[model samples]
Target: MAAPAVVRDLREHWAPASAQEFMLDDVDLGNRRLTIAGRVRPLDDLTLKLLLDWLEQRRSRWPNTANLHLLIHNQTADTTGRASSHWISAAMRGQDAPLEKLRVDRQLEEALPHGPDPLHLAEVFGLDEKTPMRYADSARALMERPLETDPATSP
Candidate 1:
């Protein structure tokens, strides 16, 4: 028999995990306010995208020297409230190492200056929105409900 469909899946069940590691501390982008989702658990696409934009924007505003510093810097913690400290550190030290680190940081800094932020990373990468619930409450509220159209009722 086919495996039971994963019950809640990413879209239905799953709550955000609240840890200091995943908390978004202070992210200020001029007059524009970015809604931070998944403070408690892994972030969804909307959250990740906004974060990438913010980080990249910051990276760009600085000179090449600062960019280089970011490339070499080992981030034990993300004061930016973007991701868990462990994830951030791992990503920094992961394969492609400095390049990956630079890319992530650059993404965040670049996103900071923009308005409305970009669509979440999930939408971009085509990943399932299987994020934990930490952001769900907020996400549900923010997203517009799809309008239901009855086929029997002609437009």
Candidate 2:
């Protein structure tokens, strides 16, 4: 819950590569930042609290374990390895949306508010240099479209 929640809230990638690479040190609650894939992104209050609680539970369950991954499970708790990429999906099986969809929705949410600024999107999301431009273009088109009016009210 905490992992998927963070992914949805912060627009961070939780794909196979990222899921298998997350470390406890990547989350800096004191600084309210998460360093993932070389991107140091801010963490919201709700997400921060969730993480803190999760950490407390983790410590209680595996006090002597040496695993450093933030999302450790029953099988990976004792080793210094990350959970498999499918871990997020497995954990989110009954959730409203998949982790990937959450990330896309988050990107669109950000793009709508900050479109025409692909550079900002790319910088914030660590997207491929050209990827943010696509989202920016979509935002631009959506913004340019006229709003619908009721036929009865139309002149």
Candidate 3:
């Protein structure tokens, strides 16, 4: 499968583990929000709509699942279990480490454009302030560097 498809499948498989809940009603569609480990976060309109549609379809397919958890194994009937950090690391078994690179690229891009407000980054990305602060420092150093230009190559 393509990388994007793999990522999407992994994301869907991991959603219940990340959110720590199984009930479709746990998601507050009317408010366009979802809670992750007790922290409430707003959802983009597209995500909210897609989730609603998925839930509706799931409900129709499995009416008895209304009171049960959202993600259940088709054969085993077990809740989608959480993956260990070791499992995640093994899953990204590649020299390039695409997931790590994507995270770093996103942080740098966010920092470069905004001058790196660590607090803002923490709130917006639902991350710890320390991580954003580190990104902010990197951004500051990058902003201080002068661009190197060669006079010989000037047009």
Candidate 4:
């Protein structure tokens, strides 16, 4: 039997491409869709983040890098033109209004230049540029496991 394909640790087999720096903007996650500066097809935000993190890591190691991207749509109004507040509420489980609008830009900043922030990822994983792919992989894996009230913090 052929040996199972060994998936190399992204850190080991990863190398950034010699491509121009691609700009990512107007990212709207309200509906988990994004409209990249120039591209097509609505990409999942989580997927984009994972790829971006990997690319950034590779870039740090290899200055010359190439990147790929796809445009996505954030459809706020539904097919019937109804507000998504009801859906959002149902998703939040009657949580505080402020909590519902939680976007952790600052939390992401803290998690960078060191390593993953267990405290932040413990709640929700953000595929922001600051995150590392290895960290993201671990965080996503942990989602399946039982939640630990107390999570480790980045030093």
Q: Model-by-model lDDT, in order? A: 0.33, 0.73, 0.55, 0.33
Output candidate 2 Cα RMSD. 3.1
Candidates, ranked, lDDT: 2, 3, 4, 1
Candidate 1 — worst ten consecutive residues by lDDT sum? 1-10
Please say which candidate is ahead in lDDT: 1 or 2: 2
What lDDT, from 0 to 1, does candidate 3 have?
Answer: 0.55
Per-residue lDDT over 1-155 for candidate 4, one digit per residue giving the tens place of the 0 to 100 score: 11101101111111111011122333343444434323222333444565455445444643432323211112311122322333322333443533312333333333453345564443333334444454544545554566566545523
Per TM-score, the best of the predicted structures is 2
Please report, as a residue range, the 10-residue window in candidate 3 with the lowest summed lDDT: 1-10
Kindly provide the TM-score of model 2 when superposed on the true structure, using C-alpha atoms: 0.77
Name the top lDDT candidate: 2
Q: What are the per-residue Cα lDDT tens digits for candidate 2 across 1-155?
A: 33445433433444556756768889888899878787887765776977787788888988998998887777888788777766655555677786677777677777887756799778767889888988888788888889989999999
lDDT, model 3, position 145:
90
Candidate 2 has an lDDT of 0.73
Put down candidate 1 lDDT per residue, 1-155, tens digits, no spaces.
11111111111212212212222242333423322252223444554454555457545643242222111122322222333323333332334445434433433443334321344433322224542122333344344456678889957
